[model samples]
Target: MKKTVLVFGLLILALLLMFQFSKYAVISGDLKVELIVASIAIVFFFIGVYINKKTLQKPNTPIEEISHKRIKELDISNREYEVLQKIAEGLSNKEIAQSLFLSESTIKTHVSNLLVKLDAKRRTQAVKKAKSFQIL
Candidate 1:
């Protein structure tokens, strides 16, 4: 019957798989110990590197507080501030427009206004100015 042949075929495949696996599993005693020792050495090496890196790292300084007074002096509007934040995140005007659900032309106007307010000729300059003022 087809069922009997299928069962025998499956049995033969299972035996072949076990035989192949046994060949890999039957490593020499010395080789097994060497592999375990090598694995342990690799783990310890990584641990030592991690500890060294941690020890060499400088303590992180607290982020500077936002300067509302400077921001007020800059006279940047709330919506323009939102646009500037997007600029700081490196989003293009089209991407910002899609994210804020506004038209691309509207986003372009916002970017143009931001550039004037920030006294920068380009998006990168505007972002730099905003970040320097801590208004980002």
Candidate 2:
């Protein structure tokens, strides 16, 4: 934190020197307008970064933790666990079906069961929950 502040302070000092040097020269009116626009853009960019930094914290929901624990307690079958692994690798139902030589409908059924077991609304969420539980 201190390092960031020091670096920012140094940057401001450098800009001050640049402005001072520009004063000794014949500055055009258009140049001043350009400088104003550039400064506004820079300030807005930093403000956006600051606001985003404050809001970008990872949310640790109790439901998510409990869901993981419950999933861990579950004795998922080997086939279901394989489907979970493929899902974790970002495979779609049809893709997983193709890879595992099963029908897409069968894959859908397996995924549905996995979602119910994991207490997730989607396959991606199920995969994440499985991972959190160290089950896949």
Candidate 3:
């Protein structure tokens, strides 16, 4: 914690120094317009980086783009498919059970079976794979 505070303090001090130096340089005409342009370019570079990161975080796969071959090959049961749809809708086991008129344990079993069929270790992963396969 102390190390973190120390580092942050140093960074703050450096920024203050840079700001004062830049103010002096600009007033003295020591900083050129080229430097201003370069700073703008750097700001835009960081903005582009942030936008690219956000874009990459979201998948762009449309439903029409998802292949159906693996979906057909998986041959999931009708009930399992229903459970998968509920999972895709972001329902919890208890909610799914209530909606489907089944016990929570039964819903859990179906979720487990669906995971095995989809070869996924987590519920979210199973749903993503199912969507990618156009099964949901």
Q: Per-candidate TM vs. native? A: 0.62, 0.48, 0.50
lDDT of 3: 0.80
The clash numbers for all candidates, in the given order, read 0, 0, 0
Give a tens-digit lDDT track for model 2, residues 1-136.
8977876787678677656655644265445656665765686588669757866977887443334445446856678878888998999888999999999999888888888888999887887777777665
lDDT of 3 by residue, 1-136 (tens): 7965875586568567666766777889989767855775675576568657865796776547544566568977778888898999999999999999999999999999999999999999998888777666
RMSD of 3: 8.6
Estimate the overall C-alpha local distance difference test score of candidate 2.
0.75
RMSD values for the candidates in order, in angstroms, are 16.3, 9.4, 8.6
- Quote the lDDT for 109 in model 3: 96
What's the lDDT for residue 12 in model 3? 67
Q: Which ten residues in a row have the lowest lDDT in candidate 2?
A: 63-72
**lDDT score of residue 132 within candidate 1:** 89
> Least lDDT summed over 10 consecutive residues: which range in candidate 3?
62-71
Local accuracy of candidate 1 as per-residue lDDT tens digits, 38-83: 6556755765686578669999998888888887898887788888
Which has the higher lDDT value, candidate number 1 or candidate number 3? Answer: 3
Model 1, residue 3: distance off in Å is: 69
Best-performing candidate as measured by TM-score = 1
